[model samples]
Target: MIDISRTLNADTPTWPEDEPFSYDLTASIADTGSVNIGQFTTSCHTATHIDAPFHFNNSGLTVDQLPIDLYVGRVLVVDVTTKQRITPEDLALIDLQGVRRVILKTDTWPNGAPFPTEIPELDARLGSFFHEHGVELVGVDLPSVDPLDSKTLDTHHAFEANDIHILEGVTLDGVEAGLYHLSALPLKLEGADGSPVRAILQEI
Candidate 1:
């Protein structure tokens, strides 16, 4: 199995406009001179993460409420990177016949962008298509599946309306576009909206 998700570290990339992700050891082995202990601070949505419905819906499900099975499944990798933004037009290019799990590779990654911007927003119509088709989850390389500039975020509402889980802030830059068993599990944080994950791709 190849671990595709980036490591959860202090240097992990964050949303361009949002605050940078950070972590620090409040108590370390060097400081205590006994055991290696430390405390950290960071946004749950940092690095490779799973977005709970609660991220969008005020009363939707939390990360703890997510089914474990949803994290592992036969996923379809849809390579639709022709457009700057992923819309219905771009998704229509793929053959989603019986695909259950879908991961859109927009080449979204953690790289040399001094300040991040919402350049890639998905189309509102495509959200309905995925939900109507019963897609268990959606993973993408961008900070979000929805457009970065979306205030109302019709795209997010569309997916959250159906309890769709999303895995965002991925770094699938070198992965080949194809089907694979995905095991990108989120942390078991109780009552949390999201959790950083060690998103991995296991070849079946």
Candidate 2:
């Protein structure tokens, strides 16, 4: 069986112009009579993470409010590398008959290198597609679905408008396009807009 899951760590790539990923061991067993501990700080958007509605809406549900079934489900892998900006028109080409969860692998997976502005982003119209098609969770290999400079965050607003779960910073390097059993769980961050997740896909 093939497994398609990203090993989420501090070294994972991040959004352009966002905080760089980092982790420091503040306490070690050899340093003193204490437990080894790591202290780190990063934007919630860093690494493979789940974006709760609170990220876009002022009073929307936070990470903890997410239902259990939101992150665990059957998923479809849709390849969209040909298009720089993923739009509804692009999605119209796919056969999403019974796809409940969808993961997108595009030119943005490796995400090239971080840039000052977002290059490849998903159009807001694609967000409506997810909402209308019964997609519960959406994952992409890119750091974000919105342009780094998108102040309006149309993609985000559109998804959150339908209470959708968005997963970003996914590394779909070796994942093939097909159906898989997906598991992408986020931290139970209290009242937070988003949280890092341990995402994996198992062959069924």
Candidate 3:
């Protein structure tokens, strides 16, 4: 399996002014006379993660309520590295029939070096496009499906309205565009807006 998840550490970039990832040794072996105990604190949206519909809609399903099967299945990776604003017309050439998961390889934020100030706009029209193609999960190599400064989160809501779930912050730099088996399950955090996921792709 090829790991697509980003490394989560103190340096991992998060949304501006959001809580940064932190890990601390709560108990040392010398003090506890046993193995060291560690603890961490992070934003639900940090690193590679899945956004529950609740992240944008107060009435939508939370992380735990999402179907697990959606995250583990055959996925098609499409390269759209050149476009700044991705629309259905932009992806008109790719064949999406029978594809349940689609991971767009937008080499925009290839290294996850830092939180991006801006990213390619994912047209709200994709909601209907993906729905027409039977796509249930959409993954991206950036922080969000919508514009960074967008407060309306129109694309996010559009995905939810169409029964689509989102997987964000994936690292698809060296991965080629093709078919792969994806396993990017989010944490079963009840009543939570989102959760980080250890996303991976297995050669099919």
lDDT of each: 0.76, 0.77, 0.93
Q: Give the TM-score of candidate 1.
A: 0.87
Question: Taking the tens digit of each residue's C-alpha lDDT, what string does model 1 give over 1-204?
Answer: 766676655566666554566556678778898887665667778777888888777897888989989988888877766667677766666777677788888764444333256556777777788876778688887777776666787877877776567888767766788999998888898889899888888777
**Model 3 misplaced stretches (Cα beyond 4 Å):** none
What 10-residue stretch in candidate 2 is worst by lDDT? 109-118
> Taking the tens digit of each residue's C-alpha lDDT, what string does model 3 give over 149-170?
9999999999998999999999
* Model 1 lDDT-worst window of ten: 108-117
TM-score: which candidate is best?
A: 3
User: Candidate 1 at residue 53, lDDT?
Assistant: 80
CA RMSD for every model? 2.3, 2.6, 0.8
**Candidate ranking (lDDT, best to worst):** 3, 2, 1
| Candidate 1 lDDT (Cα, 0 to 1) | 0.76
Clashes of each: 2, 0, 0
